[model samples]
Target: MKQKMLAKAVGIALVMAPLASQAAVENIQYFGYAKWGNIYTDNDDHNNGKGERNDVIRASEGYGNYRLGNELNWWEAGLKADVWQDGDAYFDTTLYLGSGESWGDVSIIQMWSAGHGLFASQPNAKVWAGERFYRRHEVHMIDIKYWDTSSTGIGIEDWDLGFGSGHIAWMAPNSSADGRSLHNIDARISDIAISDTADLTFGLNYIFTQNSSYEESDITTSGAMLSALYRQAWDYGSNTFAFQYGTNALAGGLMSAEGGSNRKYSTGVEHDGYSWRVFNSGDLNVNEDFQVMYSIAYQDKNLDNNDGEKWFSVGARPQYSWTDYMATALEVGYETVEAQNGAGTNDMYKVTVAQMFQAGKGVWARPSLRIFATYSEKNDEWNRGGDTYGTAMRNASGKDSVDEVTFGFNVETWW
Candidate 1:
């Protein structure tokens, strides 16, 4: 009797498979963005002290992405694909067909399989593997990924946890010889009531690395990182505050060059120390036609006995819209860096004004064409003696400060 029942169920499923396939929707999409422009400055001869030309204003470097993907579904397999390139080489290189040379190599930034319904308890969960862009958050104006832990990894995302959700991922270096692998776990809780009109969210992330030897020193190393975030939301917009602390080997993740040998003070060595950063971002809308976005970040790191370094940056972008398609924007940014042991301090300032044409009414709307003018100033202590601007100017004219103005028009869009 049980065998008969099982056979009957299998026959019914085969008969319904065609009907179910017809009712299921399959989707594919391609999306990308492009930006280009020219910049001209009043003076183009400034150099850092080195012989290299350190022009204050030059042509803008551009970046682009080409992505194609299918919609994720529980019962069907899908593919996520991407090709990306950045920097001036993409514009300056010459094309060659069969000479074993090309303009530039296009990189596969991400190519992965993604789908949902991996677990019955977490029906909304998304499971994926292969090279991909993991969770990364950034400060828009400065292009700083304050919470960047992106890597080639496998992970499950949006796992329901009653009150919120969780994600777990494991990432490894492309080559086993580079370093040991690492695992990351992140949890986010949302909609904690702050008031009738406000809500709060909290997030925690942790990373741990396996033991590995550093190629330069041949010393075994391992490390960990912990990060926390808090956010508050209201009718107009939201604000986010975040902090991260890590050991020297894991400050910016085991694969990050920023905290290891590539750090400014640590040239080809890693030591026992600590690193931390504090960051905040705010988006506020004053009215239908006006809005503001601002971000501030501070980071400090100490390695062994080396003089620790401190960095601070703050920037703001404000815009006023006259209509859905027209708006004016002004942006100002400043950054300063110093050594804790009084090695030196450097600072720079930049300002930009732009008249923009966009398809939408908000400050965050994309697909924009902008006519812009930018002004920038650098102090004597800010990369002054290096090869580009400071050394070039001092060598040429003995100038202590460098100022520049750039004007250009550029268009950016995505679909």
Candidate 2:
């Protein structure tokens, strides 16, 4: 029901945001992002959910989160207000809460509001509506994101289209899988600087299947995707590259375009697909007690049934400081997946070495306090244990290769 009336109008606008900001709220702000962790693994053969080293040696499932102590007990916090104004025309609002993996389960995940210069010839345009996570871009050491078009309908964005900077939205999807009745549209033309440190963007995502019984054949319920991104900045860090293409029903936007396809849309020949990626992580301060944070990724996925996947990943997380709050961090990661219908290649390698007590000194300093130990090695066909003795190990400690050892502690913060 329109997402329960937009969650009851975001709970009545956070309960009328302090009586509507005491009549025309001027400004308000608060923000947060967090990560919490707990991991313990030591090979508990079979039922792979207990030793849960995130299902034994991670990364390669929609590929993101490349095991850097893979922290994921998420959190987000928010507030941003600037209620009512009229000159440049204003209304601004933002509210986020988010939390996952328990903790009394919270929710909100942004509630929107926008108005900014309601067109006096597009005074830097803005016009918005509820629920959003729009404009997202990330790659923080394989934490993945390369443009997002989060949903909940309604949009219009920064328009200074002197060549770039434009957007569009019209969501309505929150779920679907044969339950049909979907619609999504996202478009963009971002940044576009292209020099003095580069910038460029282009995007599009379209989905359709507003079934009325497909209204008499609608191209088998359309789907489209196309994307491009390129960024470069170097004073220390910044690098990203992406490319995508899709067909048929891509409903899940684009996670580097799909290689774990279970998607079967019968006729339409599985709607061809392709993806691309490249990365270089952040905070590369190479001096002053050594600092680093690196990441490299190469992705290739071509879908149409089964048989197409190619992924390569590389990781880094070096830190060395014995002063400014103590430090020592070492994280190494490796990944390989090459399949072309033969189940022929698989690889995983990890190493985590931590003992830090940080707060400041490169690597985006953080609420760092880690005490870790991790070790990994894989390729027991990457543990596919459907056993009865179909062997993915664990028939009386069968195995040849498959190893793990983990111990964790992590805490991350952002504001």
Per-residue alpha-carbon lDDT of candidate 1 for residues 1-415, written as tens digits (9 for 90 to 100): 6676567557546643443354332332444444444444555463433332223221111000000000001111122221112321111111111101111322334545565554666667777776655666555545455655555677777777666566777765322223345455555555455566555445555544454445666231544566666777777887888777766445433222212222211212344577787878888888899998888877776656453556777778888999999989887877666545454555567788889999886667887788877777755432324311011112233324667765666665555
Name the 10 consecutive residues with the lowest summed lDDT in model 1. Answer: 62-71
**lDDT agreement of model 2 with the native:** 0.65
Give RMSD to native, each candidate.
14.2, 20.8
The Cα local distance difference test for each model comes to: 0.52, 0.65
Instruction: Write one digit per residue (lDDT tens) for candidate 2, span 1-415.
Output: 6676577657757765683457667678887888777878767773465865554355333355554575657788787888888777888888787776755566777788888888898888888988887787766766766555566778898788887789888876533335454677888888889788888888887766565354334334666777777778787666666666655465223452222212322112233354454555555667887877877766565555443456677888888988897788788888776654544556677888887787877667777777788887766332234311111222244334677787888777787
Cα TM-score per model: 0.68, 0.32
Candidate 2, residue 364: CA error in Å?
19
